[model samples]
Each structure stands twice: as structure tokens, then as C-alpha cells.
Target: MITDRLSLGLQLLRIIVAFMVGGYAINECTQGFSSEKWPTVKGKVTSSTIKEVFTRSGTSHHEADIHYQYVVDGKTFKADRIIFGGANFRSPKELIEKFKADKPVEVHYKPGEPSVACLETGVNFTVLIPLVAFGGILAFMAFADMSKSMQPNSSIGPRPASNSSGLAQPKMQQVKGIILFTGLVAAIFGFKYGINAIHFGAIPGNAIAIVVLVGGGFLFVTFISLLPAAAGMLARARRFDLAEKVAKLNTKIASTMSAHSYETAVAYGLQAEIAQEQMKYPQALELSKKALNVLACRPKVDLAVNKFDDSTNRMIKESTIRYEKHYNDTESLCNESYGSILFDMGMYGDALTHAEKAKRLAQDNLRNAAAPDQAGTKRALAGALALRGKIELAIGSPENAKSDLQESIRLRKEIPHQFEEYLAASMADLASAYCVQSEFRMAERTIEEGLKIVEGSNKPSHRLAKAKLRAQLADVKMGMGQLSNAESLLMESLDVREELLPAGHPEIAKTYLSMAKLRDLQGKQRDAIGYRRSAGEMLTNCFGPQYQAV
Candidate 1:
């Protein structure tokens, strides 16, 4: 009887809160800012009354007991719960009078459960269930993972999920991320509660609640003081949330993992790639070099494995080849990415040096490639060749560019299974080589093929490649004196590039330069100068003051 009575009290509380929310305000809250997308339907109130349920202690709970019916597919369902006040009524008495008889009302039904209806829709009580469900699943998985990692190992085997220094590794970082996430959510709720308590001016009476809240906030701060937000990094890193990417990567490096692990090296390499894309050349060079430094993991890996039993050592030794190949592949890709950064910095000598290193290392690693991992080695090799070709073109060696780009295209074509975007990229570079040598017709054909490849592939990165191909096609059209076609292609290329790239990215400047060329051809000399000046400023900002615009 007490359980049933308490349930009635809770339902009365819900009704009282909804009634207090005010007329039409609930409608705005439901439709304007509702997190859930609810479909609306027409309904009418059949009955309305105010009722009081008394407890054994003679305490009474007053609520508006209103029943409404809505139809779906010729079937009708009734609900007595009032989500909020309706019909321009400001008070419960007004609601009772307004809803005494049949009155049309708007109803919002749960998408999958049409029987479940509400007078007004907004973030309801069920929202926390999703958060708790997600957090509980992650917490359980993380706990289970830690249990496995906690298994006893030989004295020589540093903990499997951490480094020798006992700090969390990348794998364990995620495995422990739930604690931080839960603490963050707890802290937010606690802070909100404390604020409400103070607003209500319930001192001493709400003092215990405030203390519990303070403790929760402290735990949250302790976890977050470990990072700007540890949970946010785990959440947004894979989503490619650009605003938080570098900051999260920086936090990932600083907080949990050792600076020298292979995973940490990958993080550094990723930051370097981002820096290069943002046109921060000096920082990108430093970051890529740091990635290479951290990737020198051979001695540490070998030493750790040597401490095991002979049979175990031998088995681990057999797997060392895989580690070595991964190391080489990462190094080659980083070198190629660094070379491109240098090429943009106008450090042609240094750019060509690293470009050759990337190409040589990629070629050397190919001997270890078998069918299982052959695609990765070939991808690194093709990427190296493509970067070298671009660098060679910048150095005024068209022949070398042509040779390298052709090899990149040929090698990439063999891996067509998952490499359409890459093949298209290499073909676009080859088209540039042809244009540099005044072979405009060949350039047009190569670039058109590149565009066709991108259009057919449907890869997420296809639009980026298509933009480059269109830009190349524009240059070829200009060379062929098809000014109108050239202008059209430039506009298309510029639109895509501007949409996809950061404001200071090199490709955007290149598109601006093409625009300048088009304006010059059209005899709009002043507009040409304006475009040229804008392109020059952007390139200068990207590559620093040392860079000279073509």
C-alpha cells in the first residue's frame, strides 16, 4: 500500500511540475529546442478534474487529472498525464475550466510507440536513461579490460597495457576513459543542483546536498585537471571534430601515454599532418621530426622481448618483422608528408632530400611485403613517389616529375580495390607534369580520367581529389586558349576547395592564383591584380615571408 501510495505521490509531483511550467511556454520549449524529433497529431481532451490523494499521515497531493485521446491508423489511445498547461490557460483552475469538455489539442507521439503520447514535447525524464546506458556499457567494458590487463605476467614483461613507468598506454587510456566520463557528467549535474539550491536560498537545510555536490565537482575537476577534457578527446578524435582535434591530440600525448610509444608517434604524426594542412610549416616540420624520433622503438621492443623464455622469445622474435614493417611504413609516410610540408615552405633542397629518403625507404621496404600486407607497402611507395614528383616539379625538373608521377600512377593502379582516391590523386599530379611541359592535350586527357575515377569511386575523399583534378583541367584549358571552359572549371574547383579546406590552406591560394589568371585573360586587369594580391598574401601567410608566389 505504501509503494502504491508513493507511486501516486511521484505522479502528482510530475503533474504539479508540468502545470507550473506556464501557458504556451511549454509549446515553445517542446517544438523549438526539443532534442527529440517528435511528430505532431491532433487530439482533444475528454475529461479534466482536480483531485487530491491523501497519505496515511493525512498529507495531501493535489494534481490535475486530465484524460485525452488521440488516434493513429483508425485506432484510438487515451492518456491521463498532462505534459504541460495548454489552451492559453495560465493556472490550474483556468485549465480545468478550459478543458471541462471536448477541446482540440496538439499531441506529440513517440516515433516508434504511437500509443505513448504527450500534450507538449521536450527533453523529458527518459533522456538520462540513454546517458546512463551508454556510460554503464563503457564503464563495464573498461572494467573488464582492466581485469584482463591485470593478469600476472613474468617480471620482465612490463604491464601489457602500460609502459615501464606505469603510465596508461593508448589502449588503456580508452579502457580507463569511462571513469573520467562518469565523473564529468556527475560534476555537471552536481554543479547544476548546487546552483539551484543557492537560488532557492535553502541554506543549512540544503547544506548536505551542497556538500555531496561539492565532492562530485571536486572529483570531476581532478579528472579534468588531467586534461582540458579527457572524455572529449575519446569522443571527438574519431569524429574529426576539427575545432578540438589538435588540442585533444596534445592532451592525449601529455596526460596518459609515454612520449616514446609507437602509438604516441602516430599521434605526433597526426598532429604534424594537421599542422601541415593548416600551413604551419615550422611547427609541422618539428612535429613530424618528433614523430620520427619517437618511432625509434626497435631497441626498446627488442629488449622487452628478450627477457622472456627462449620459446617465448623466439615466437616474439618472429613477430618482430611485423613491428619493423610497421615502423618503416610509418616512417616513410611521415617523411613523405614532411617533404610536402618542406616543398610548400620553399625549401626545395631539403624537400627533395626527404622526398628521396621517403622514396628510397619505401622501395627498400617492398622486399618484406607479402600478399597479406603488400597493399600497405605499395601505398607507402606510391605516396612517396607522388610527393617526390610534386617536389621535383617545384625544383624545375619536369622530366623527373613525369617519371615519378607515372610510376606512382602505375603502382597505385595495381591496388585499385581500395585506392581509387589515391590513383586519382597520382593521375592528377601526372596531369600537372604534362601541363608543365606544354602538353596541354595530354594534360586534359589525364585530368579528365582522374576526375572520372573520383566520380565513379564514391569515396568520402573523392570531392577533394575531384577539386584538384578540376583545377588541373582548368590550367590545361587555359593553356589550350579555351578561356570560357577554363573559367568555369576554376569556379567549380574554387567552390569545392573553399568548402573543404581551411582559409589559409595552400590549395585555396592556388585556386585564387588560377582565378587571377582567368581574370587576366579576360582583360580585367584590376580584378586580376586584386585576386593576385589576395593569393600572394595567403601563400605568404602559409609558407612564411620567404615564399614567392608564381
Candidate 2:
């Protein structure tokens, strides 16, 4: 009998709290809308004071206590309420200053009841706290009841069926619904409170608002992070589709080529050259072969067989030479494209061989021509130089890498329309080369120039490059014995790298290693060890234990 009574009492309390919360919410909502249409009157603040109240735990909080008189319908009324549903504020200085004695302010009052007056119309802590608590309690109770019903042999009859994953599908749906609903409620209140805090210009209120906004933002990011990785897969699929399209076009153009149209062949050859420049080697190779086939199919008009003059023979020979040069240029670019792709794939030896071959072919072409293809020759030379520099650096040949990188930089500058991103990247690599040679000041200056070029760009590649340059700068600073500046730059680099790269990326591991070095320089032995351990673990996870040597 006592157990039954206790259960009954608990149920009664839950129902009462639920009703009270519902009624409070409804009243506040009605008053909020009603206030918009409420008549305004000039009111004088008769009295205003700061009141301090202590909680049961003896923590004191302050509130502004203001009494004002407003005349409505030719009769004066006194009211203490500042805003509908608002409780005592944590810091009431702003409110107190606003409601000084004899200060005239606008008062909003109900049409029939002049006693119902408010300075503002909004739901506040007075309503929000109870509403949230009671709502949460009700939801918990419902969830508990549902769980009890779902158990085996419960009086509530058969439970819902579960899916193949052994989880009740209905329950999963309910959980998702609850989470989404709670998030929506939090977002709405967070935004409303943030705007209100800003509107009132309350310092403490603004702090609370910031916390709410940040929490809401984190929740939003977490929600988005749960989405499927469809976008990345779709992008990869699209690139493959484009590559296939290029292959098909090349085949079609190859089969339809005629003997009389060398111009058409040259156009396709240029297209192939462009594809090679973009590092699409498979497409470039296919197009280059097709262009070569078209050139081979051109009519062989020999002057000896046709009994033509020496001038005509010379003209024919000149045209053939031009065609052969174009074909050789396309071939060289295709080799360079292969080299670039190999470089990106970390096949250093293969990349170096192809890069050298492309460089030699471009040089030979430039030497033989009366008027060289200046742009093509420069592009091929610069690309080969950059690739060779990177390969040398990877193989620990700092002097060779520095020489090639410097030459590449000079060549890139000589080009009329310079590729800024590539130039900045080469500068960053050159800075790293300088760092490898312990040329701290030169490394710092080189990276600083690169940063100036890329710092303002929002592209991910630019940002990633900038992060890498910052890490190199940090290393240079460390070499210079500027521990404090090195630490700061490393931290900034880590932030950008973490934002740009995926977790456990090699770049992130390198940044951690730099941070460890900085900590060691600063005499933080414990922190240095910890950072080094983190770097080792990240590198091991990303590239196996052998790569953790750094």
C-alpha cells in the first residue's frame, strides 16, 4: 500500500509540473504577441535600486528593482515588471542605469488592463528554465516507460520488431527524432538570447550569448559531420568520366583525320600539349598518338616525283620540318606530364628520368629552331627544373635541389603570365632547401615572400601551401635560436594544417615534429617528449613505423 501511494504521488507531481510548464509557456507566448499591439505611453521611473539575493548555497546575485508609473486611459498605474517572463538578471547594472529615478521611458500596457505593463516582451530565464527542466523530465519518463514496455514478458504486449542490426528500428527513429527536436529547440533559444544580449548591450549577457552560440555552432558541425561521404566519391567519379570523354574524343578525331588538313592535326596536337601541361598523362599520350597518326597520313608530295622546282621542294621541306617539330614538342610534353604524375605519386627515380629527358628534348628544340616556341620551351624547362629540385631534395641533396629550384624560380619569372601558385610553391620548396643547408635568414626571407603571394587566397591548395611555408619558417626560426617566435609560428601552422588536412595526414605529423623541436628548444623536456611521441604515433599510423624516425 505504501509503494502504491508513493508511485501515485510521483505521478501526480509529474502531471502538475507538466501542466504548470505548459500554462506558463502558453501565457508567455500570448503576451509576447499581444505586446506588439499594446499601446505605448510615456512613463517616469519613480524608483530604481539594485537588489541582491542569495541562493540557498549563499551565492549572491543582483537584479535591478525598478518601480515606474505610467498613465493609461487617463489613469495612472504603478508596475514593477520590466519585461514579461523575465527573472532577475545576473548583472543588473545596465538595467539599473536605464531605469533611473524620473527618467522617462516607453511603457507597453495591455488595452483593458493598465496594470499589465512591461518594458519589453520576451521569454527569459523565468520561463525558459522551468520549461526546459519539465520538458526534459517528461521526455525521460516517456522514454523509460517505452523501454520498460519493450522488455521481454512485459504486460504491454509484444514489443516492436528489430532490424538485422539487432537494434529496434522504431527506437532508433525515436532517438533521432528526440535529438533533432532538442537541437532545434537549443538553436532557437541560442539565437534569440544572443540577439537579445546584443540588443541590451549587457556584458555578462554577451558572454553567455557567446557560449550559447559556440555550443550551437558545434552541434551544427557535429550534425553535418554525420552525413555520408558522397561528395568525395562523386567528385572522383566525375574526374574519371572526364578522362574517358577525352579518350573517346581522341579516338574519334584520329580515325577521321584526312591528308589535306594539317591544321586540324596541329589543333589536336595543341590540345594534347595542353592536356600534358595539366598533368593528365594518359589523355596526353592518347592525343599525342592520334596527332602523330594524322601527321603521318598527310599527302607525301615529293618534288622529285612531280618534277617540281627547287623553291617548291624547299617550301615542302620547311613545312615538313615544322610538322616534325610540333610532333617532337608534343612528345616532350607527354614525357614531362608522366614525370609530374610520377613525382606526385612519389616515384622519385622514374620522375627524375622523365624530367631529364623532357628537359633535354626542350633544349634541343630550342637550339635547332630559328624562332623557338618561347612559351612551350619555358614551361617545359621550368616544370622539369621544379620536378628535379623536388626529387633531389627528397634524396637529401640540398645543394643540387637549391640550384635547380633557383633556376626554376628564375625561369618562372621570365614567363610573361606567371603561374603564381606554382611560383609560390617553388619558393616554399626553395626555402625548405635553404633550411636543409642551415641558411636560416635566406630560408626565412624566401618563405616570407611566398606567404605574401598566397596568404590572401582562400583556395584550399593555397592555404595548404601557406601552412607548409609557415612550418618551414618555424624551422628556420628554430635554427636561428628564436625559440619563442618558432613556437608561435609552429602553433599557427598546426592550426591551419589541421583545418586543411585530414587527421593523421603526413603534413600534420611534420607539424607535430616541428612543435616538438620548438618545445625542446624552450627547455620544456616533458612537453617535448609528449609532442615527439604524438608525432611518432601519427607518422606510424599514416606511413608505418619506419617513417617515425623524425
Best by TM-score: 1
lDDT of 2 by residue, 417-438 (tens): 4335667788888998999889
With a 3 Å backbone cut-off (N, CA, C), the pairs that clash in candidate 2 are: none
Rate residue 316 of model 2 by lDDT.
67
The lDDT of each candidate is 0.63, 0.62
* Candidate 1 collision pairs: none
Question: Which regions of candidate 1 deviate over 4 angstroms?
Answer: 1-255, 297-316, 369-372, 416-419, 456-460
TM-score of each: 0.54, 0.43
**Weakest ten-residue segment in model 2 by summed lDDT:** 1-10
> 486-511 in candidate 1: lDDT tens per residue?
99988988887787677867888888
RMSD of each: 20.7, 28.9
